[model samples]
Target: MKRRTKIVVLGSALLLTAGAASAATASEAPSPRGAAVSEAPRPHEAAAPETDRPREAAALTGTAKLHRSAGDDITFSFDAHLAAKDKADPMKATGTFAFSHYQNGDGARAEVAVDCLLTGGKVAVVSGIVTESDLPGVEGKRVGVTVHDLGRHDRLGYSWAATGTPAEMDGLPKCVSSAPFEKVAKGTGDFTVVPWQPEF
Candidate 1:
């Protein structure tokens, strides 16, 4: 009976030791399947890099010259030199103006178009409408002219509206040449140019 008692006590101690070890192992192990998970970042919540920010439009000021063709169906070809109002870069422009009379005899309208080459090897095509008042007078009067881009695939787009005067050279009753002429008028204006976002 003493021997049986000794065996029983030994068995109880062994069982308790096993139970404590099992409890410790379970506490150290990872959690079961259904615990909460951390969320991934959303697109809107992320911050944009500094280089990805959009560029602001630039203000520009410059000069222009128009050599006009005489007679009823007149043609005015022009060249413009422009500098950014706040920057050191310059732009060059060359284009033509063709006039058409209104059927109602009110006045005349001119279709104007020009190719503007900017400093950084970019090209923009500008076009707009003009009136007789926009032309340089024989007395060298300043006139207002406005033009916008023709949707060319340029990063920088341009639109300008400014006043300028003409400087006519002494000659005969003639029309403006298709090429640059000696007897040309001078013009100047101010406007803004904007840049488009870059494609990835």
Candidate 2:
């Protein structure tokens, strides 16, 4: 009877030890569904809000005029009043140019290059060529000018083209010899221009 009692007590103790070991193993194992829940953000944490910003302005608008001196040595005078699209400051420039006149199959051609400085130390360099038709009429008298901007090496620059009819002038150098030419011309038309590209 005494030995049977001791064996029963030992068996009960072993059963309790097995139950504790099984519980520890279950606690250490990870649950498949709950794994992702641990990585989710807490309710109080939030993402930053975005804010609005202003964009940079581009392009300038204004009027310009070009004068051609009639003689064997043809010369050009250029002037313009420019207003920046982004700012209220007004800019003015005056430049002198040397041109070559030639007779093309279609008509007369004039090519010019100019370099000038603005009031505030800004530089303006222009290169252009113009053509006049040989036909008789408004079309024949019409002059087409193509202007290009030689941008500053460090920053972008601007350019424009304008054309007008000849008018009488009071003060100008006399033609070396009597020739058929207009004395003065005012800007009456403008061509759409694209903004100069920035230089890296």
Q: Candidate 2: where is the Cα deviation over 4 Å?
A: 1-72, 86-122, 127-200
Off by over 4 Å in 1: 1-38, 42-52, 56-88, 92-104, 114-200
The TM-score of predicted model 2 comes to: 0.18
Which pairs clash (backbone N, Cα, C closer than 3 Å) in model 2?
none
Colliding residue pairs in candidate 1: 64-187, 68-176, 69-175, 69-176, 70-175, 167-185
TM-score of 1: 0.21
Compared with the true structure, what per-residue lDDT tens digits does model 1 show for residues 1-200? 13211110100001011123342333335556886764655998766876787333222122222223321221222233333332333223333333222212222333333323232112222332232332233222112223232122112111211111122323311112111112223231112234322223
- Alpha carbon deviation, residue 191, candidate 2 (Å): 22
Per-model TM-score versus the true fold: 0.21, 0.18
Per residue, candidate 2 scores C-alpha lDDT tens digits across 1-200 of 13211110100001011123342333434557757655554656643443433221122112222233321221233332222332232212112222222222112222222221222223223322222222222221112122323222112211211112211111212111111122222332231223333223
Poorest 10 consecutive residues of model 2 by lDDT?
7-16
Look at candidate 1 and tell me the lDDT of residue 20: 34
Q: Best-fitting candidate, measured by lDDT?
A: 1
